[model samples]
Target: MTRIHCLVAAVLMSLSLNLQAEGADLYPLSSPAEQERFQALTEELRCPKCQNQNIADSDAPIAKDMREEVHRMLQQGASNEQVVDALVARFGEFVRYKPQLEPRTVLLWATPVIVVIVGLLVITLVVVRSRRNTETSSALTPEQRRRAEQILKDAEAP
Candidate 1:
């Protein structure tokens, strides 16, 4: 009985997993160029509801509506930039998977590069400082070495 229950649960879980994939819309377009544009736009735009997913891959209602809007705009002969701009205006820049390079997003875009540069500089400074300290400390005079050895010998004496 337990084995039967496990099997039923596994089947149901698999069906639920596929439900999202099955929910994708099939929009019609006029030409291959338009079809390519539609595909590109849908795949490029992120779903507001599914933060990590694009509209083409997400099953969210908002994603479906966005996809429909993209299709309608394309059919109305809107340029790709116009369609994207309209969506961005409606949903804010969060809808764009790749944000435009502007003053507001400059810090976000530059953070990784800034971090890497700082890390490299820190490593270089540490290495150079360590080498300099080693060089200075290792330059012990012969007299100092003899005195240090005598001190060690005296310490080890009875």
Candidate 2:
């Protein structure tokens, strides 16, 4: 049982190590512009499989395919926008690090700023309310203090 567990662990470690290996630049470019475009697109497009990583930096098979598609489209004289739109159509807006500001995606772009503003407002309100409560609670009239003490004494006696 231990030997089987050890073998499984070794295989998993080896697979994880392979995942980190850099994928070679296998797509040959005929022009410097194509090369630059390829580099930019790969860096700009996110890997569908690795949500956090751009296609250029990811070793996932889907990233490899996306890179190949971008190279092919650029070779055929597609504009950067054309290539990006094609990828977005296939993989959804999640493929772009910065999705365009369409009505559907405006919320996606605005959500972070909105969340931060809302959070700040909520925190400010909480801080103000707490300060007001403390200020109001801190000073009691002599009559109120005496009444509170009398109540406490009655409770203790019961």
Candidate 3:
């Protein structure tokens, strides 16, 4: 039982060490500022393969390559904007988590508001039409009212 416990402990320790080594290889920033920049940049950049996930949280190969490229650029004394611009130039605006508000993206930003306004307008028209129909239906013509009264009297006589 003691030997089994020792073996289990040794295995857990080795696994922990291997995990640490793997994590260490992922971030090779030399300074605190470089690390901070790396974290910020990774979070700001979206993974192309994983459309919803940032590069830092994605396990895709493209994300891994982007992380390596960011580290390399930072190591070579690149500014945050410089690294971001390089990536943007290579991958286009889709890779950016926060797209810039320019002419091209104006439609993208305005689409939700436009949809809401159109929906409200449709609802207003529907409600107005429904109210008008109810009002028109309730207002019977003189001939129609007389016919209705005669029908009611005949039914009562029977």
lDDT of 2 by residue, 88-139 (tens): 9999989988778999888888999999999999999999999999999999
Winner on TM-score between 1 and 2 is 1
Candidates arranged by lDDT, highest first: 1, 3, 2
User: What's the TM-score of each model vs. the native?
Assistant: 0.75, 0.66, 0.81
Give the distance in Å from residue 104's predicted Cα in candidate 1 to where it truly belongs: 0.4
Error of 1 at 146 (Å): 1.2
Candidate 1 ranges beyond 4 A from true positions: 1-25, 141-143, 148-158
lDDT of each: 0.92, 0.90, 0.91
Model 3 Cα shift for residue 19 (angstroms)? 1.4
lDDT of 1 by residue, 7-105 (tens): 999999999878745543367678888888998999999999996899988879999899999999999999999999999999999998889999999
- Model 3 weakest lDDT span, ten residues long: 24-33
Tell me which of candidates 2 and 3 scores higher on TM-score.
Answer: 3
Clashing residue pairs for model 2: none
lDDT of 3: 0.91
